[model samples]
Target: MNSFDLSIETYLSNIHFGHFATLSIQAIDNLYTFKGLVLIPVLWWMWFQQDECHEWRREMVLATLVSGIVALLVGRLLTHWLPFRVRPVYDTELHLRFASGEIKDAVLTNWSSFPSDHAMLWMAVATGIFLMSRRVGVLALLYTALFICLPRAYLGFHYPTDLLVGAAVGIAITLIMTRDAIRVRYATPVLRWTERHPAPAATLAFILCLQLVTQFDELRKLASGVMKHL
Candidate 1:
């Protein structure tokens, strides 16, 4: 890490340990669930119900999500070309809140941490929202910075520049998606197909979402419980 990356990353790369600390970590780690799943939907729903252009709002929401996933993929590919770096905990002498009891699966040591997929996805959604409502977009940006980026840094998952460049990738892709020509050429067709087959489209979205987020405490527990009988 260069001085800029190291200075900011070091400033952020410390955490508390214990049960409460675990809870806090899990909560921040679920920033995607709230911002992407909860907040974005809520904002879109509010706008949709009030707007004369309900269909447009619906299509835009779907397009925005697609943009987020695409941004994540693009960022993922970018990491392969950059100098390799392991997750902060694995590569550096940072203080970590290992399994002090908030939860298990305390450390993920091998994953590449060059550009954060979380940063890319969250910023893509934020960019999409900002396109619609500046206030909501700014709010989402703040939440992404504090709740999403900070905790990941504190927990030793990423360097600040990793998150920063990932955000840049997301913003770039989302801005392209927001273009009128691109929307007319690409997004409209996808929306039309989705309108024609909402069930399959919804199913595909759920599956892709599963690929994006691997940690789900309740869901994992439920899956484990079900597997015990088999």
Candidate 2:
């Protein structure tokens, strides 16, 4: 590991018993709940759909979905198939737990903590949207930092390095997809014609329908996990 990685590990280790760490973990874990994950996306999409930049909305939506899915799949495969790392909660030597109190039985996984899923997801969304609107992009980045990154570290689910790496992956995927989308959506004569006379309402509806269909499998999985926990 490099000096940066070592520094992060040391920092995480030092905070094992801190009250702030306990609070951060709790806040971070709360974001994994169904409402935070699902409702936020729905509201975000709805808001953007109503924006005046309707022509760019489709590109933004497509980029967000494609980059997010790619990041998630790649992150999962890398974490699961590569050398696995136990979470701090499961590390007896670390003795990390809720500093406020003892945690109840929680569903834990023994996966590598190199790239945090939450960080990647939000970062992908932020990056994709940033390609569309700078203001929205800034807001998205802030949301990811305050809600996703900070909370995950506070809760011991991931080190700061994991979140940082995940953000990098998300940003990279977003940039690639956005560049490709621009090339495909604008470079073609037929596409340029369509853009000049955009069917915003119709396009928005179609994209929304596609999103609902594409998200069904993921939503089902999330529901199943919630049921299992319940």
Please name the candidate that would achieve the greatest TM-score relative to the true structure: 1
TM-score of each: 0.74, 0.65
Candidate 2 lDDT over 7-80, as tens digits, reads: 55556545664567566556555634421354236435743576576645665565566667677777777787
Superposed on all Cα atoms, model 2 deviates from the true structure by an RMSD in Å of 6.4
Off by over 4 Å in 2: 1-28, 32-53, 95-107, 180-230
Error of 2 at 102 (Å): 4.6
Q: Model 1 — which ten-residue stretch has the worst lDDT?
A: 98-107
Estimate the overall C-alpha local distance difference test score of candidate 1.
Answer: 0.69
Candidate 1: C-alpha RMSD after superposition = 5.5
- lDDT per prediction? 0.69, 0.62
